[model samples]
Target: MDGEPGRCGAGVQPRRLTSPGCGSGLDSLERRVRLPSRACGFLPMNYLPFRLLNDRDTFWGLLWSRRLSGSDLLRLMVFIMVACGVYGAIMAGWRSPRLSLYVAIKLPLLFLATTAFVSVFNWMLGLVFRTGLDFRTTIWMVFSAMTLASWILISLAPVSLLFMLSGVPALGTEAELQYAHNGILVTHILVLALSGVSALWVLREGLVRLAAPGCPVGLVLLTWIGMFAFVGCQMGWILRPFVGSPFYPVAFMRPDCLERNFYEFVFGEVMPYLLQGGR
Candidate 1:
């Protein structure tokens, strides 16, 4: 009774500053109940890029975490894109030592155009479909999806670098290097496809996180995905020659973007097949 408040005799102790769980205050209680600081630090900001780059759960958590604002996600997304663009552009440049600068220019256009097109696409889709997501949030989701795609590409930088350094001799005849060059092009296309799929997967997960449980993907999402693929392919074709040319001795933008337009190429590749199949 000397300093204790309302002490119960013998078995029970007074609720005092030193008593366990007895009026210790919220701060102290929080410390006892809280997760370790390191574990909590993994949630949104600190090392999130690394986690999203590697951890599937962390990437999924990113979209759902209340702690992450749309703007916060966008900022991180842009940072990832910048890293992707730089990594890809530099590797392209480094691969084609003579025309490195030329190889570098197209990728930035590809990156910027892809991002811009996706944003506009989201806005237009939102207006038409009247989905739950607003224009800004729709845009942010697209940004996040592409960020995942970009992270995938970033992971492939080393593979691209390896390809850049290895292959048939640069001095060899075109016929001699044709298959090897085709292999390189095929590899790039595969990487691009995988990255696109990665983006789609991210989009699906994020939407699921936003949507009601057990619901199917709506028509709005389906349509958006179709347009996203078409836009991505056209953009890729427009900014061609990401991999340096092994055929042409040296020329910045060798065939050049305007000269290598996609429509004519696609029509040439697919129209004849369709016509023959029809016949």
Candidate 2:
């Protein structure tokens, strides 16, 4: 009876009861349990502790990170050239000989100005996008988009003005002056609307980067003020020639023409210089 039922100890089962395979079913159940898979994969499988980057090192790193494609640079250059040509044609076309030469002389200045504006706008956008502090490529894109928009608006301004004037009341002296003034006002409003839209578009792209602390409010405000002042000064200069001249030809000059010039001064000179100085 001892050999058959309790070989090792009194009232104890055989050693086979406590062997490795005794809990095989329980081990299989435990092995089958697993964590659920993530759909988006936003969270890391393993996360390390956060560490702050060095200020100078981080800045340099960011500066080096921003890069542009050949096509982007080419587009930027073409846009600048086209914008300058359009502005020059608008400004000097009526004056005859001054047309070609003025455009030629002003081309360089226009190029410089447009380039600067694009650069700053791009930098602002980059900061907003939080693209790790790199700004070179961002600026290139901004400049390209703004320049292209400006070219399109300038090209369309004359056609739009002509359309507006076709409906004016042709009667009294007051009516004539009012009509002229309204034409100018409307053209200016259109140009500004286009420029504003372009700026907002550039800003939208940079907003992500700008979400961090220490936004460039001061720089942006200063840029705007500088642009306004430059426009005022240039307009004053242009108008000074005819300020008191009774012989000033209103017949040859459209009110919309003056207003458009004012905007050109703002976008073509003031904004660019402000950004250049800021840099």
Candidate 3:
């Protein structure tokens, strides 16, 4: 009798969770304990950025289901500016402190300006392609994709800085400087291409979801890319001096920036070779 199970605690009785929703208390407690015990030490709100990168399903789901408020947009814009700004500063560090500061300002401005100029067109194109994307949704989609790219660029800033310091000479002969500029330019192109590809991959599912039955998601994506690149390249040309060539002075914009567009410059340079080949 003394060794009886019920007698172990004497008068204390086992409590039964008979009330509805009572089990939730234990579940909540479990969650509270388990959440803090996570190795990342990330709180729910703080983990949203990571979720944006790795959890495409949830990220797009929230955007598609819920209307994002002004604060949401502002927060996203802030993140974009901060992330892009960091990479921009590092990108021109090899040049000088002034150029780094100039680039840090211009890079984010480039992104924001491009988005602002293209949003309406992008939305209309989405409609034509039957993607069911409204204006706000279209803007948010682009912003979100750009945010991904910004994150990627920021992540690679350290590597870029290393290459800038080691490979690109701050002071050298004209030939050496030209070679260094070419190498740095190519490096940035590759890094940007990778980031663009990754961002597009993240948006692939969302594009499909928005697209109507039988609509070609690939074509829609391509069209959007063309528009964005067309505008963005010209913007970059306008916001030149990001890399701060040793031959050129450190200015926010070149004096001849608006004299010609990027396409004109490209065409002028390539036509000479094309004509020579036909000759």
Q: Which candidate is the best by TM-score?
A: 3
lDDT of 1 by residue, 239-265 (tens): 556766665556554356667557787
Go through the candidates in order and give the C-alpha RMSD of each one to the true structure.
Answer: 12.4, 23.7, 12.0
Better of 1 and 2 by TM-score: 1
List model 3 lDDT by residue over 1-279, tens digit each. Answer: 211211222342222122223477545433322212232333343244554654444455446544346677787789889988998898888888999999999989988999898889888888898876778778877888888888899899889988988998878889999999889888888888887887786456567644455667788888888888999999999999898888888898899999999999888876777878945
lDDT for 53 in candidate 3 is: 59
Clashing pairs in 1: none
In candidate 3, list every pair of residues with a backbone clash: none
List residue ranges in candidate 3 displaced over 4 A.
1-40, 43-47, 273-279
By summed lDDT, the worst window of 10 consecutive residues in model 1 runs over 1-10
Query: The CA-based lDDT of model 2 is what?
Result: 0.41
CA lDDT for candidate 3: 0.73
TM-score of 3: 0.81
Per-residue CA lDDT of model 2 for 1-279, tens digit only, reads 211211112332211111113377335323322112332144321110000011111111122232235663554456556655564444333324344345434543544464464466545544654443345545543453455445555666476445434533334476564665465446544664575466444333333222233545445434533553454345434433211112243222334545556667668888999989955
Q: Which ten residues in a row have the lowest lDDT in candidate 2?
A: 45-54
Clashes of each: 0, 7, 0
Model 1 segments more than 4 A misplaced: 1-45, 54-74, 90-95, 98-105, 212-218, 249-256, 259-261, 273-279
